[model samples]
Target: MARLVYQPQSPLNATLAVSKRWATSLGIWGVGAGTAALFLLSVTPLVKREFLVKVPVVGSYYEDKTPASDKPF
Candidate 1:
C-alpha cells in the first residue's frame, strides 16, 4: 500500500483557503446589501412622504388654529 502524506487539519490551513475567501466575499456582500437597504429606506417615496413635508416658499403651511368667526372671541 502507498504511504499517506501528512496534511494539516486546521480550518486555517492552506487547503481551506477557498472557504476563507468565500467567507470574506460573503461579508462584503452582506455589508453592501445592508448599505443598499439603508439608502433605499431613506430615499424611497414612501419614506419621503411619511417623513418629509411639502412647503411652498417660506415653510410648512399648517392648518389655522385661530378661533372661527362663529365662536366667541
Candidate 2:
C-alpha cells in the first residue's frame, strides 16, 4: 500500500482571501459615496444667496418669498 499525504493550508493564503474581501468592501463604499455626491449635485443648486428688504409696514425682513436659486425649482 502507498502512503498519501496532503499539504496544510498556509497563512499567506488566508491573508490573501481576507485582503480580497476588504478591497471589495472599500470599492462598494466608494461607489456609493460617489453616487450620493453626484445626486446631491444634480438635485441641488450650486449657488445660494439672499438679501434683506426694508419696508415701511414690514420693517426689516429677509427676501425669502421666492427661491434663491438662479433657475426655478
Candidate 3:
C-alpha cells in the first residue's frame, strides 16, 4: 500500500499567493487612475501649485508666468 501525503495550506499563504498574482495588474490600474486624476485636476490652481509645478519636465508648463502687476486678482 502507498501512503498518501497531505499538505496543509495556510490562509496566509493563500493570501500572499493571490496578492502576488494580482500585484502587477493592481499597480498598473492604480498608476493609470492616478495619472488620469492628475490630468483632470491640472486646471485647478491647488493641483497645479502642489503637484504639477513640481514635475521636472512639465513644471514650467504649469507655472504661472503672469507678472504680479497684471492685477486681475
Candidate 4:
C-alpha cells in the first residue's frame, strides 16, 4: 500500500503572490490611461463643448483656449 504525501504551502509563495505590487501596478495603469484620455481630449475636438461649458470653474480651461505652443500630443 502506498501512502499519499501532502506538501505544505510555503509562506514565501503566499507572500510573493499577494503584495502591494498589484495595487501599485493598477494605480500606474490608471494614471497612464487617464493621461492618454486627457491628451486625446485636448488634442482633438472629440469632447463636446456643451460639457465643458456646463462644468463650473474648470470650464474655461477646456474651452479650446489652448495656444498652439502649449499643445502636446
- Quantify all predictions' global Cα lDDT against the true fold: 0.63, 0.60, 0.94, 0.73
TM-scores for all candidates? 0.35, 0.34, 0.85, 0.40
Per the 3 Å backbone cut-off, how many clashing residue pairs does candidate 1 have?
0
Off by more than 4 A, model 4: 1-20, 46-57, 64-73
Ranking by lDDT: 3, 4, 1, 2
Candidate 3: which stretches are off by over 4 Å?
1-6
Error (Å) of candidate 2 at residue 2 is: 23
lDDT of 2 by residue, 17-72 (tens): 89898998999999999877755654333311221134355323333455567546
Instruction: Give the per-residue lDDT of model 3 (tens digit) for 4-58.
Output: 9999889999899999999999999999999999889999999999989999998
TM-score of 3: 0.85
Model 1 Cα lDDT, one tens digit per residue, 1-73: 9999997678667657877779988999999998777557855656445543343552233323457976675
Rate residue 33 of model 1 by lDDT: 100
Distance from true location, Cα of 14 in model 4, Å? 5.7
Top TM-score prediction, candidate number = 3
Which has the better TM-score: candidate 3, or candidate 4? 3
C-alpha lDDT (0 to 100) for residue 61 of candidate 3? 92
Best by lDDT: 3
